[model samples]
Target chain A: MKDVILGIDIGGTNTKFGFLDRDGISLVQGELSTNEGETVHDFLRVLYQEVMTKFKKIEDEANLIGVGVGAPNGNYYTGTIENAPNLKWHGSVPLVDLLKQYFKMPVFLTNDANAAAIGEMVYGGAKNMNNFVVITLGTGLGSGIVVNGQLVYGHDGNAGEIGHTLVNVNGRGRMCGCGRKGCLETYVSATGIKRTVYKLLADSTDYSELRSVSFNDLTAEMITQAAKRGDKIAIDAFEYTGKVLGMKLADTVAHLSPEAIFLFGGLVRAEEFLFDPVRYHMEKNLLHIFKGKVKILPSGLGLNNTAVMGAAALAWNEMERGATA
Target chain B: MKDVILGIDIGGTNTKFGFLDRDGISLVQGELSTNEGETVHDFLRVLYQEVMTKFKKIEDEANLIGVGVGAPNGNYYTGTIENAPNLKWHGSVPLVDLLKQYFKMPVFLTNDANAAAIGEMVYGGAKNMNNFVVITLGTGLGSGIVVNGQLVYGHDGNAGEIGHTLVNVNGRGRMCGCGRKGCLETYVSATGIKRTVYKLLADSTDYSELRSVSFNDLTAEMITQAAKRGDKIAIDAFEYTGKVLGMKLADTVAHLSPEAIFLFGGLVRAEEFLFDPVRYHMEKNLLHIFKGKVKILPSGLGLNNTAVMGAAALAWNEMERGATA
Candidate 1:
């Protein structure tokens, strides 16, 4: 029988599971509610039940090789979801161990952000790059740093917290969801654009459409649409957000010296509205050796399939390196 | 014959070469003026001639296995010293090829700071660690970032420039030797402390022993002596220096999540004056997950012999990696 691996992305809202051969082509796909209960057992049970139906039909056609999982706070070392704040699960959950009992196959797990980085490396533009960064710009900024072609999971499994790194170290700036002040995410994420827009409305006297909107009413999509129509406040918000992101990324460039930085998420859909200012400011602030040297590119993975692809790529990588390694 | 490897540390004023066993015991050592002429050819000739005398005597007892040279702006990938400003050589110098023509042994090269890092990994506190950073607090702050038990050379072999990373992004800050403003080194190195003192002298009315001195007349040693004697300005300078260094290092901890950050240089001789504030500010600024977890410790290597040990360790590492690797 032909061999295939299962990729599962356990997100806050939904869990997406898909089966793909070692070649990355999907053989089957589906999703289940991740918040169905506090534990992941319910979701995995339903996912497996659905997959088993397909597996029995394909028994003579394909073989299940292993399973790969991606989740917030997922630890590659422990294969546990360690108190991921977004998930219904409150504390460290042994989701991988639970999956293994159901799937009865070799299991591998890593943080969702790191899985995305591996996806970029395996099936994206970074296939040839050994050093690069993958940044997810969703509600908050999530980052995965790759060095020498391996994800940098530091002393703790929580090595890729670039969002929380300080940007404005001066007086009390924006407060972050992480309970920190002046975090990079406080100024650069989807929520960050709203924060910037709020600040811009308060600080500037320019006539703008954003001034009419309340904090709860303002959305990143609305701001992008406004900027596309040449709204000064909306455009300024992206520029300011890009300025902060580019400057902080310049610092990251100094620290890790990655060959490129990959942008993934809805913010990337803004195209030049976000990319232009980020490139401008990152280059403008970088050291001479790094100035104009690093590339900022969109992720090669499709936006909808990114998380699942990341998990699949992780399995493919483990297969190549031997699961134990 | 007893096996030996030659370790060379080329400084702006002095070039030191020493022969050592795989175990790192120095067998023969000597130094010569590096600026014998405008070119490295003359310097290498004098260096080789002095070393030949020792080699001939040890010919019956030792066999030379390899050579490792550490120089400013040294590129490990190319084995070339690219535009090292401190050296008499004006542009890129193929020192490895030149050394090979003379010594006839496999040669390895990296920046002086990276060499120090390898030294720490081989003979110092980071022997077993796969991730750590070695920061050299010298004429200018130099850093070598070790991730996954190897130095991060980036794409251009210039990855560790933590010194040059922006610490002060405010209005036109202190100008750095590299022509950048507000570089961490401008405020944290031997010269950096002096710069801080100069600023403190200009900005503050607080009286101290430092007021009696001019910029050229002052030295880092004097500041340490004053701080040791409980002089307020000197003590404040070290505190401020450590505060800045520690805060920036917190950002680094966020990036690489190194297990321990090893401090090396003359400033470290101040002991608690520097280390105390660095630890304090680093912890104060670190994210909660990383807070109180990362260790900031003094390097285990001797100050005078660190460069030598580092180069020796590089050769030993190369030998173990099968030279060709």
Candidate 2:
């Protein structure tokens, strides 16, 4: 029988699952509503049922060897999901423990960004790198730092929180869900660009297509589309976001000295509109020694497959290290 | 004969050497002028002669096993010191190769801060910690980041340069010897406090004993003494320095999630004058998840012998890892 690992990515809106072989080739994949069940246990039960139904289709040819999961606030060390804001689960939920009841295979989990980093190392552009950072830019920013070929879980399970570091310290700046002001995420994420567009509309008299979009209705895709059409406010928003991200990344380089920083998630789709300014400002702000040494690249697993592949990569990595169920 | 490792710390002003047992006990320690020779080879020759003479006194009880040297801009991966601004060497100098000519044993070389970090792990307060940061506050700030009980050497072996990260982004700030402005060290080191005192003296009309001292004559020790005596300007300088250092450290904690941060060197002698504000501000700025979790502690290796112990620890550590000359 062909050996396979199960990869699961639990997001706020949907939960995606896939079965893949050692080379990261998916045999089957599908998604379900994350809130289909009333409780955490109910959700996991449904997920397990859905996964088993999918696995049975290939049961004769493929063998299910292990399971891996990626989710917000997932703790690699504790095997729990700790109060992830986007999910309905409000307290520490023993995710691994619940999953173990369904699958008698080695199970591992980590925060989505860390899983993405592992995926990058095992299957993407960072295959040869021992030290690098992965930045996930979605609704909010998330990061995964790798050093000496191992993910840095830090002293606690929650080490990669680069999003929350301050960008402005002098005055009360942008408010963040974490209740902090002037955070890097407040200026660099998809929501960050939307916020920046509004601020630009307020400050500049220049005609912009974004001027008509309601604050709640505006999206990063709309802004990118507008910038492509020569919208001044949208273009300025991307520039400002890049400036903030580049400067903070320069600081990150000083701290971790990663070989490269990989940018993933939605905002990266802006392509050169985003990459150009980020590369420019990151180089401009980098210390002389770090100049031209660090590369900024896109996620290599392809955007559609990142979450699943990340989870799969985590499972494979843990199993190789001799971790048991 | 008892085995001992030779530890050498080459500073701008002096080169200190010590022979230490595995238990971190010093067999003998001494210092010599760093620039007594006209060239790099001459300096190494004189250093070798001085170390040999010192070893003769303890030769009956000690057997030399290996050597470890720490200097500014030292590279562990390359075993070279790369154009350190404070050192007279203008280009890459093969420090390990030069030291090998004398001992014929295993030789290791790394930056002073990295050596100190290894010392902290092997002998100091962080003996039990797997992730921690060490900040050396002297003429300029230097840092060593320990993740998973190993120093982060980055891609080019210059990972821990937190001192060069920016604390300011607007206007022309204090100039750094590294040709950058507004670096963290420019505001938080020994010379940083002096610059702060001068700025404070110029900004306010408060009565102060520091008003009589010139910039060149002023020192961090003098500032500590003045603050102890209730001199307002001196006290305010320490407060400002603490505020900046604490804020930056909060960001560091966010990135690394280190269990504790150890402050070392001359500036730490300010005691509560520095620690109080740093703790308060760091606590005030830390993310809720990290709040009250990370500790700010003094270096457990003490002040006078830290360099020697650090280098000794590096040598022993490398020997255990099977690195040889």
Candidate 1 - CAPRI tier? medium
lDDT of 1 by residue, A1-325 (tens): 7788788898888888788786678887878787674456776677778778767766787788888899988998888998889888778888777887887778999988899999999888799999999999988998989998888988777788889888867435788877868889999889999988888888999888888888998788889898998998888888888888888898899888889999998888788989999999888778887887899999988678789989988988888878752
Report per-candidate DockQ: 0.77, 0.82
Give the alpha-carbon lDDT of every model: 0.86, 0.90
Candidate 2 segments whose C-alpha is farther than 4 A from its true place? B170-172
**Which residue pairs of candidate 1 clash?**
B2-B61
Output candidate 2 Cα RMSD.
1.2
Model 1 CA deviation exceeding 4 Å by range: A54-60, A205-214, B323-325
